[model samples]
Target chain A: MANHTSTQASFENQTTWAGGRSPFNVSYGKLMMWIFLLSDAFTFSTLLVQYGTQRFSNVVTPITTKWPDPASIFNHFPFMHGLHLPLLFVSVMTFILILSSVTMVLAVEAGHRKSKSEVARYMIYTIIGGIAFLSCQAWEWYTFIHEGARLDGNTFGITKQGYDHLHSVGFGDHFEWADGDRTFGPVPFAALFFIVTGFHGFHVFSGVVINVVVYIMTVRGVFERRGHYEMIEKAGLYWHFVDLVWVFVFTFFYLI
Target chain B: MEFYNKPGDYDAINYIPHTESHGTKELWKTFWLLLGITVLDFVIYFVMPASGWRNFIFIFFGLVKAYYIVGAFMHLKHEKINLALVILVPMVFVLGLISGLLYEGSALEVMKSM
Candidate 1:
């Protein structure tokens, strides 16, 4: 008993970050993944900050407002062509992402249990969610481009008359921009929209690919031979990070 | 200490800490919370006119959603304190950067007007 107590005391006295164990108590891959995510967060934050700066710099004046209200521009829903449906489509996109995030976490949880089949199942659900989101973004981009928004230019500069017309229409009302209601707006508006969402869509696309690869690995019993499923956990971290970034993109881009 | 000093035997590459299933109760709870907040965001977007307060609310909700996603989904809540701080502390500076640049942006607006 005395020796056991002494051993316990020495263990308690040992430094937490001794060279043997991970200071973070996580595996090397997971720790590196966290660091990578921190850097990626900075990337996304810088983009958002640039967005905010561009928007605030183009404040509405008595003459012309450069920044267009997202609602006035992104107020279309699939199958509801002319009706004003601000936030509806993006809301669906958000739901899909959140659902996918949940499924990814579920896969991680199953991985912890070494439940191979369940992990694969949740991974499939997550991949489907990602594909769905990508399709939605494609439709949205097509619509925006079809509406004449371009990388080098923006046609969404709402005139005073356009503002008034937009205000007169209620949610779900049939609304279209009348002539003279729009002018060439700030170039960064469309450009940043494409850049930010395009960057995020690319992340989602890669996330889908990663999920597919991990799914294949799981099916091949690689993890079973390795005696762990931490790969799913690592992929889950990336997946959740994507969802986290979307929360902000949804906030700054659409809702605000 | 001497036993630990042999780095070659440590196998850092494969040293995954043991993990266990903590069940899906909390995860599902977090999902509901995120979904409900999103719904609330939608409702408030339509209900409240665009204003500073509305923007503040949206940002606040965004942060809350971010918290749940990172904490529950990423399992940061169960991570070591050092790990959590290392990951989260730098974000405080990000908030500072956002505010500072926003102020600068407004100043630029004034300059453009001038």
Candidate 2:
């Protein structure tokens, strides 16, 4: 009985705060990646919190003080010009991000199985998805800028008549902003839109770059020689984090 | 218990936990779940009239999407509880910040009216 107790005590001691192994059971690199992601999350949350505060402070009055309705401003669909397709384009963008996130995870899983070609293939798919999302964002920014939305000012605030007109138009119907409909509204409206989404877009761009580098490394049999594909797992964590941020962005920016 | 007398003998930087393929089935399921929730969000946006209730629903769905992404896609669910807590617990403060500022924001609106 004394031998059994001693053996169990030593086992417990080995697992707790041991100098040789990580107490968290994660590698050094992966733990750093998670910590970096946590810091990034704080950054994004601060931005979003500022956005919510600014929006709430500008109470929706009859005309000038009202925050612009996102659906009215973001109703454009690519190749379907002059049609008021509210929420459709952004939905497509969301779908692209979600799809790419899946591909990234698939690549990580394939790496676990030591399937070189499969990891490469999935990484390529993920890179394509990131590029596609970036393109969609480019078009969106262009359309917004073209509509007189600037970083310092916004002309998308719908007047009472404008709000009525916007409500009258059905989905996919031809619509244009009449002269009396728009007035200069809250400045932070356009500013926050650009800042938050642009930040996310930059992340997608970097994620694409990282994915390409990883793809090249995989092709060169670097991981095979190292006997582990842990790099893919690290990159996968960043990719999925970007997706997680978008879910909140979609909710607060467009859906709300 | 044996201890490494030299730091070079224990390379912590090169240490990685052994990983295994849990199959693509769970990953694909999570993808579909995320997709379905998004579709539902789109549908509700069109079907329901805008109200506090609608906004609440949207926020709820967003949380659900976030859970699946972090839990399944990021593999946090399979990680040790200690790691998960370390990553997630700080987010509570963010939530608190959001709620506090939103209230303060509404109060600012009242002040502006004055």
Candidate 3:
């Protein structure tokens, strides 16, 4: 007991709150961000799992109009209209996002070196990459609404034809499906597509907003004044997580 | 009061925070590996015949990319084990949810047959 008293006194010099400088010496904010991201990951995982369940269970015997093929649905690139570039534009978008991640890491690295300009430069590049990715998403959504494969009148939303009938018969506005032909399949597939991808798009949009705010802060010398760029590093963690989720979405939705 | 780190020498920066700088070499290494994996995924999708194994390959490559992003880009590889577990443990639940639903789906299919 006498010997333990000396060790207890030694810890008195250490902050009682930290209990020896945090487990793994992790910063409070970063740890909290990680926890938040973990929760977010679970949310996304559930959506995707549910999507998989519905899709595979609905696989039919004839296979004429199964679930929509993503490769065909998302095969357009900007300015190359009507071209059949399967997964190329999406791949470009993926690479852009990955490139932004690399730039973010550079920004964090520069921050470590206390190079304000370097951090700002890399941060600007990262923000631009985010904007590019958002633009791609917009193009994708536009193409989906106007040109991508549709289920038409299928009960399960499985048919990929009938767009020509819509145009030839002056069914311009209501291309989704005619009520008379609704027995082919239901509309769950399109609804699910919008829900899942819309959810992901919303995340990316929010991430871009966060990145813009952080970019403004970086340019304004806030981190430099604080003498640490951990702020940018924290933002980088979030950006990377967004990119990571996209990796899964791209595979499950498009490539696979 | 806000805590801020003092600036370190350019060369010494990586050593000061006990956190390695995301050096260009390390960043590019991961970037190339991830890019290559994605390209391979596309190739396999195009060249290979559709089968049960194809989906598994896609998942395998996807997992590899996820590991890299988490480890290198997110810097979790360098983080303490306690901190890493903060994310890893919950992921078990995610996996459970996925596998459980898949099993349930198969069970339902069997029921339909019977």
Candidate 4:
């Protein structure tokens, strides 16, 4: 009888300990996510700083005629009328990303409840949101490329008058009219923009792929078997990191 | 089957109450505050006249939004204060670097115009 009583007590103690334990005792996946976010933040900050430096150095040029404006550069849509939309696509992308982050949080919450169905639903939403954002980015890139905004060129296909109008407006006001003859050679600015933003977009794409795989396993009840939503929480960290990077991008690329 | 009915069976069972899973009203309150900051940023950017005051307003709103993003979204507020400081100090350095570079670049531009 004493042996049985001791075993019962031990079981109770074990259950209590496990129940009361904090999520912090989980593995290093979430911690590593945070570190990755910090390093990625630094990479974006450096790129933006460089952009700012270049912009400031060129500020003395006549704002009306010489500056390249981001609004004009990114204004095209294939099916829409030739409306000079400013940051519309980017705004949509931003909203999609933010919504994805929200879905990610919901997924995390579902994970906490061990609600596999809820987790799968939210994860699907998150993936959809990510895909939507990527599609918008691709469209934006297509427009940019179609408009002849090459990395090496004297005239990025923007007329001097258009360039002036763009400069008078706002951020992305430092781009210049590529020389008309296409003889002025490649401008390094376009390359830099592509590199930085492309790298970020690549991160987003990879994140979406990872979440999709996780979602599949979620549907198969893998995490349910593990008896915890730690994976959801880790994925939440990644989603939030992507959103955080966009906050900086919006500031440096748009608002500033 | 033996392990399933082990003495510590309940310990292996994870049960998270729905109430604990869905953050309480406190989280909503924080979300509202962040939205308010975002609105303030937009207002400052669009409504304010271009001047030193406008610039100040923009910077202030930006910092506020950044603070909330770091504190609330990143859960820095729940961390040890020293951890917050460690993370924030490097950000401060980056900001300083930005300002210095902009200043030097602008100065050079001015000199070139002369």
Candidate 5:
């Protein structure tokens, strides 16, 4: 009995040593998630700050300056033209993302309960939600590209000039006036729009991939062997982070 | 040492994992809260004036919604208070940075207009 007790104690000590000590007593995965989120927060902050600066500087431009209203800019379908629908597509995208976040939370809940089927069901729903968001983003991008917003010379009519030009150029020069109708060329605004939204879309894409992997593992009962769905909880954290970023985007980019 | 192998040791280390059914209730509550805040956001957008009172209202509601989403949905509320502070402090700094940038940009605009 003594030898057996000693052996168990030794094993426990070795296990503790191998695991290393956490400063906050949190799990390794959770700690890493926090760190990753902190860095991501910085990236988003910089993007928003820069966007605000540019927007504020442009606001002083004269009313004649043709800054593309987001409503007009985003309202339309790619290839299937003349839809003239404002924010309809984006609204659908937002709904999908938000719904997916809900499903992800459910999945995390199922994992906590150790219900394999429930967890798998919710995970699949989350994956579909993610895919829907990506599809909407793709359409948004395509519509943006098709609109012919030029990244080069005064194409679409929005100029990056400061307030000084507001008096001289007015808002009309801000928009492209050609062939008796105002048209936009693909230029700086388009470029910036693509870069920011594209980056966000990529994050969504990555999130979908992560969800799919987790879904497959859950279906295969991998997490069951471990007796928990901690992995799902971790992935849910990431999904929520993406959703939080979109809240800021909706406010700053779309509404503001 | 002896406590480590006690019958309730596992329970001590791990939170009493709420059942999936309980989690569903939590999820629904979160969804409703989010919707409420979104409605409030739209109200602030349209109903409030652009300056002074409106601006204050918008910012206040925005922060409230942000906190709700982050705190409840993101599980920051379940985390240690210190950890929550770590995340929130940086966000506050970001807001300050945004305000500073807006101010500077406006200043430059005024200068050029002059």
Candidate 6:
């Protein structure tokens, strides 16, 4: 322990840090959070990049079959089923996430002011927004599995539905799964959707849980006693990162 | 002050960031800006077919949205240069990865053409 401390001190002395608690004027906790989030960013970027690679690579859209378009898959909205609105519900879900990011920022601001009630309010709103986004994703996933009728399709597609109404109207019989030489995977499209969106949905679930735990702690006066609401700020960082990743996912997976 | 106070301190508030009271106005502004951009993104997608230019604009707006969230909401714009670079520098590698993927993907497309 003594040698470790001396070596750490020697390293600090070798640098211009001067042995202060924070090396970059940022608290140790916040800096560590940023570094962790940076690594997580790389993970997501790699996932999406691989998605792009697999999507464009090895995709031969024969006249008899075309890859599944996102707009056609996500067209169904609640109670307005048959409207053929392209990307409407997905856009709504995106805005819900963005709105949650806003609430999280407000919660961080309130934390800066050391206003407990304000923090609780904003945190609750943010949590609610997170839940709403999760609900939307669940519905989207359900619709995908139900409509595509791929029971053992991918690792993520769990449920199955008999009827696919979109097939009756939009791009009828667009996939020739029997042609092994043409399609990328047995069902590459479904596989990619399940992997990318399922991973993102998992992140949302964790973020919501983190927010709830932090909200409870805020209500319990943990940060108030600790002299700062930095935990809330950290949570806000994670929530915003989730939103940021979703923005890229929407563009790459849905639109482009 | 609560953590560093040497007993009998005058300030009662246990604040961390000695903020200058800018309030949440900027948060609201960024929210509106992001919302407007999102709506515009969808509208652009709706109005325009998925052409080269359309895809470029879609990715451009996505990048802008990412910047807004990181800069405004996460307060990276206000942080130190080292911390900001710590996050941004790794992102360039992501760009590299995407470029490489694009090349490989286009190669596949070319093969399909052939």
lDDT tens digits, residues A1-256, model 1?
3365555455445687555457777888899989999999999999999998998898777766668889678999999999988889999999999999999999999999999999999999999999999999999999999999999989999888887888899989999889988998999999999999999999999999999999999999887777788889999999999999999999999987
Worst 10 residues of 1 chain B by lDDT: B1-10
lDDT of 4 by residue, B1-114 (tens): 333222223322332212236462444455566556555655554455444465445455556666665665555676556546656788788878876775686776687679
Candidates 1 and 4: which is better by TM-score?
1
Candidate 1 segments whose C-alpha is farther than 4 A from its true place: A1-14, B1-10
Better of 3 and 5 by lDDT: 3
* Candidate 5 CAPRI category: acceptable
True contacts kept of 5: 0.30
Number of backbone clashes in candidate 2 = 0
Over the true interface, candidate 1 deviates by an RMSD, in Å, of 4.2
Report the lDDT tens digits of candidate 2 across residue range A45-111.
9999998899779867865537877877999998999999999999999999999999999999999
Model 5 Cα RMSD, 1 decimal: 6.7
- Rank by lDDT, highest first: 1, 2, 6, 3, 5, 4
lDDT, residue B40, model 3: 90
lDDT values for all models:
0.89, 0.89, 0.72, 0.62, 0.66, 0.75
For candidate 6, list the clashing residue pairs, or say none: none
Residue-wise C-alpha lDDT for candidate 3, range B36-92, written one tens digit per residue: 998898778778855658877887799899999999888899887877887888797
Docking class of 1: medium
Cα lDDT over the full model 4? 0.62
TM-scores of the models, in the given order? Answer: 0.93, 0.93, 0.81, 0.74, 0.78, 0.83
Q: Worst lDDT window (10 residues) for model 4 chain B?
A: B10-19
